[model samples]
Target chain A: MQERLGKWLLSWPPLAYLVVFFLLPSLIMMFAAFRYPGDYGGLMPLTSEDPATGKLVLDITLDNWRDYLTLESFVRLVDEPLYIELFIKSLWYATLTTLICIAMGYPLAWLIARSPKKYRDLMLLLVILPFWSNFLIRIYAWMILLGPQSALSKAINLVVTAFGHEPVSLLFTPFAVIVCLVYVHLPFMVLPLYANLEKHDMALLDAAQDLGASAWQRFWKITWPLSLPGVYAGAALVFIPALGMFAVPDIIGGTEGIMIGNLIKQQFLETRDWPFGAVLSIMLTGGVLLMAGLAAAVGRGKQKAKQKHG
Target chain B: MAKRQSWWLWAAAALAYVFLYLPLVIVVVYSFNDSKLNAEWVGFTLDWYHKLFNNREMLVAARNSMVIGVVSALAATFFGALAGIAMHRYKLRLLPFLVLTPIAIPEILMGVSLLIFFVLLNVTLGMTSIILAHVAFCIGFVAIVVRARMQGMDNSLVEAARDLGATPWQAFRLVTLPQIMPGILAGGLMAFTLSIDDFVITFFTAGVGSSTLPLQIYSMIKIAVTPEVNAISTLLMVLTLCLIVLVSKVSPGALRAE
Candidate 1:
């Protein structure tokens, strides 16, 4: 009985705190999506005081509920193609970033995993150190590097001009956005891929090699197939955060590149349309949840197939 | 086992490291540049560092971040250690969900929803709310670290303490607490760095005059980012790097445990 009481004492504080803070707020955001935008910056009131009773009453009526709340936010999202296009563009950027992270991080993760044990820790630290630095600072570094007068920009523009083309600015283009996104998310990819790659049995590779398999075949047959779980984990880590990213585009994307995150920010702060913001947030949340569910199902199916084969 | 690595892998990995380090190297280097252009190096100077120290608003933001970092770390470590203990001991479904969801979700979701929730509750959007918001997310990280530490510990010691006529509290006080102290300390440092480095959540939740260092850096981006911004960023990076090293020292495998 005493130990059971101790267990309850240990659990309830975090459980209650999270229920109030994390879970409740998410539920509220979902609820806010169905409400109407206020004339100012809040949601329209769904309740009011009754003069006679001096008590609160539900202002939303069956006849006049439309006055208080509506589905306008979702309607607006569908009615206009602009938001859809922005979401699509964000998806493309995230997809490209994930693919790039895989291409770049694969070699680095492999190298670190295959390194001498004494140096492995140092190498992994070097990879994640820049990531631990301030996020704004990292983007700000790019802002300077990609600025028109910076050496990189000047060199690229010089080449373009020599080729009889107009000078191109790198700072505010889609290229800059993708570059920053990949830079920000590269560590997420490397860490998981390394964790997965580190556990591979080298004897399997040696056997494949002794059987006259080329390095490419050895990698494709052994390493690649085994690394699928890592790839999935890394891809999820990079893709979700990249999908909703606003800061990269806000600072360096210029006029050309904007995503769903920029729109969500606008609705809450700039536009002061809470319901629309809630709606956009709900769509984003739903999309993320759906993709996550799909991935889990696919992963489970693969697990089942492997178990059956065994 | 003879490890065979190809030449292309070495070149690719070297280039990857360059990509990771170059921007930071430039940021640190250009802070000392004499020119305001941030374009090319004319000559090195300490003027940016001097100017950064003299900037009052920047100092106030730094102080605020320090206070927030310390307070939230304490609060998060206390609660997170409890949660971690519960997770290790009990067959908990809800506890893990609550603890881990905040870490997995996109940060902006937390930022916006907290904004709405605070406004709805009529709470002022300021340091307290920001701390509340931070602790919500931070609990997950601290819990994960502590739980990972707990996983490696042997059960016999605790059981032996209990069987030796010590009460449950005495057993916990003497045996378990000493073992987990390093984990608690490491979790505290992680929470401190995360609260200090946080920007997205802070952006939505901050009101007038409650600017943090990251918010101050961001506000500068709208106007202009001079070398002064670079100076503070360089300092913040060094500070966080130190804290991370301390964490690694306290618990060598803490970073990879999660």
Candidate 2:
């Protein structure tokens, strides 16, 4: 009993903090997703103050709940094609960002993983240092570069103009959104990939070379296969943040570049539709969880097949 | 032959580094440029810096950010160290899930949910709500670091101390804490950085007249392309850079923790 008490004592502060702050808030949001929006802004109160006792009473009725509380938001989420389109576009942008991160991150991770031990820490630090700055500042940096008067824009437009094409505006486009997303998420990809690559054995490569396997062939047969776990890890780290991203799209994403996160933000702050906002948040969370579950299942299946083959 | 085989790999990595650093270099360099366009080299001036220092709203926002960062970091560190120790020792299943979910959920979900929560509880929304939200998220990061530091530690040493009649507090102080102190310190630094740099959650929970630096920067970015924003961004960059160097020096292992 004393030991148990000690355990409880050690664990309760954070456990209680999370229960009050994190878990309860989440359960509230999930519950509120089906409830009616308040006439002013937030959720409609489920309780009412009784004048006789001056106490808050549990006044949610079967009639009220069935008619209004549970109908509007979920129905709107399904009935509106705009929300579905926004959701799919966000997923697309996130998936594209993950792919770009992989393409760019692979070479950097490999180089650092193969670098001399004395310089490895410095290289890794260099990769992470840029990420530590307020990410808005980083996005702002992209804004300056992609703006109309910047050299990169001028150069690209110069080529287009020479070819008898109109000058292309870059900022506030989906292109700008994707670039910022890749920039923000690249460090996440590089770190995990480096960790996995660092542990790879060189003997297999040397032996493969001795057998007259070309570098490309050797990489495809050994290094690439060995790095799948890291790639998956990196992909996951990139995708979730990218999927839920709003700030990138909000600042750089123009009329055409808005995503589901933008809509969710609008519902809460601009539109004052808390129920719809809650609904959007639940959908995004549920979709991510569903994808994660599917990925885990596939991973398990792969492991089982490998075990059987071996 | 060795050189010939690896040039392309080296080239790709070099390009990636340039891509990573060049935009930031432009931002820093332009802060010194004396042009409204923020594109051309038209001599240098400290005009924006002067303007930023005089901006009362910017000063208040910076002060708010500093206060929130320190308090939330302290609360998060204390709670996180406990969570970390308990998790490592007790194999607490529920704690890990609670710790990790905040890290995994999108910032917007957490933002809206907490906003709803504060409204429901009639908690006055401002610095207190922002700090509560920050600590809630930062505990996860600090806990992860502390847990990482606890891994590979000499548990037997603590057990031996206990066997030699040391009290739980004494065993912890002498054997366990010193082992994990670096982790705890590093975790605290990380929590501070995360809190100060957070924008999305702060946006939702910050009531009227209570703006943090990132929220300030966001509003500025949305409205105007002022060099004042550049000046503040440069200052923020330098501060975060210092913190990174400090974290590396204090606990080099923590750099490798994540």
Candidate 3:
């Protein structure tokens, strides 16, 4: 009995802490998503003002919920071509960033995994060390590098001038935003891929070679299949956060590269429309969750197939 | 174990490292640049560093961040260690997911939700609220690190203590506690760095007259990229690097465990 009580005591602190701070806040946001916006910023009463008190009384209604659930927001999103364009633009940027990260990260992860044991830790540290700095400062560094007056842009301009073309202004462009996003999330891709590749058995490849399989065949039939999970994990890591990223776009994207995250920020801080912001928040959360669920399902399916084959 | 040396792969890795370090090098180098504007290559000087020290708002923001980081790290470590041990020792179905939700969710969502939560609760947003928010997210990180450490520990040692008539509390205090001390310290250090570096959540939850270093840096950068901002960024980066080094030295396995 005492031991059981002690176990409960040990578990309850974090559980309660999370409930009060983390879970409760998320639940509140979910509830707020279903309520009407007040005149200024916060949620409003569902009913009209009381005549005796001349004050708005607190009540529950699905009016706010219905506004979103009935596709009102979706219609608004459709009606506004800018929002749809931004959504597609954000997806395009995120997809390009993920692709670039994979191109750069896969080889790096492989090299690190294949490196001698003593140097492995140092290599991994190098990958993570840049992330120690403030994210804003890192993006600022990119701004300096890509600025028109900076040496890099000047040098590029020289080449373009010699070629009878216009000077390159890289700052405040979608290309700049994509570059910084890839830089910011490259480590996220590398870490998971490294973790996955480090434990892979090379003997399987040797066995395949001994069985008269070509190198490409061995990789296709063995290595690629094995690394799919890591690829999916890395993709998810890079994709989800990249989709909702605001700071990079806000700093470097200018008006051309504004994403849904910036729109959500505008609603909450700029427009002070908490209900609309809550609606966008719910949509983002739902989308992220759905993507994660799909990835997990695919991963599980691959796992089962591998098990059956083995 | 001799394998073919892939020069192309090594070159690619080298280039990747360059990409990662280029911006960091720029920040550090520009901190000493004599020019106020970041455009020109002026002679080297320490004026920015000097200004960084004399700036009142910057110092106060740094102090606020330090206080919040330390307090939240300590609080998160305590709760995280308890929960980590509990999860390792007990079989709870939903506990792991609960811990992971904060980490997996987007920071904007967490920030906005917490802001709403504080408003609904009628709690003033300031150092206390920021610390609470930090602790809420930091707990998951600490829990993950500490739990990874505990997973590799010998279960028989705790069981033997119990068999020798040690009370549950005593077993935890004398046996299990000492074993996971390094993990707790590592987790605490990580939490501290994370709190100091956090911006989005802190941006939303920070009330009037409560600017942290990241907030100060953001405002400064938004206006212009001055050498003073570079100085502060260099300082913050050095501080985080030192803490990470300390964490690695304290628990070499902690990084790999994550």
lDDT of 1 by residue, B1-258 (tens): 537788999999999999999999999988989989888889989999999899999999999899888998999999999999899989999999999988876788889999999998888988998899889988988999999888888889999998888899998889988998899899989999999999999998888778899999998976886988888988998999999899999988887665
Distance from true location, Cα of A145 in model 2, Å: 0.4
Higher-ranked by TM-score: 2 or 3: 2
Tens-digit lDDT track of model 3 for B1-258: 547747888899999999999888988898888997777778999999999899999999999999999999999999888888788878886667777788887788999899988987779999999999999989888888899889888989999999999988899899988999999999999989999999988988999878999999889888876889889989988898999899999988676555
TM-score for each prediction?
Answer: 0.97, 0.97, 0.94
User: Tens digits of per-residue lDDT for model 3 on A1-310?
Assistant: 9868988898899999998998888888877766666777776645567899998764545555454333344456557787667666777888899999999998899888888999988999999888777888889899888987688888989999999997778888888999999999999899989988888899998999999999779868987778878888988888888888888888888888778889888877888777667777887787678768877999999999978999
The regions of model 3 sitting more than 4 angstroms off are: A46-57, A61-75, A78-81, A209-218
Runs of candidate 1 with Cα error greater than 4 angstroms are: A49-58, A61-66
Tell me how far the alpha carbon of residue B61 in candidate 2 is from the true structure, in angstroms, after superposition.
0.3
C-alpha RMSD in Å of predicted model 2 compared with the true structure: 1.7
TM-score of the second chain in candidate 1: 0.98
DockQ-based ranking? 1, 2, 3
lDDT of 2 by residue, B1-258 (tens): 122338888999999999899989988888988988868789899998999999999999999999999999999999999998888889788898998888876788899999999989999999999999999999988888898888869789999999999988788899999998988999999999999999999988999878999999999999977788889999999999888778877777686676
- Pairs that collide, model 1: none
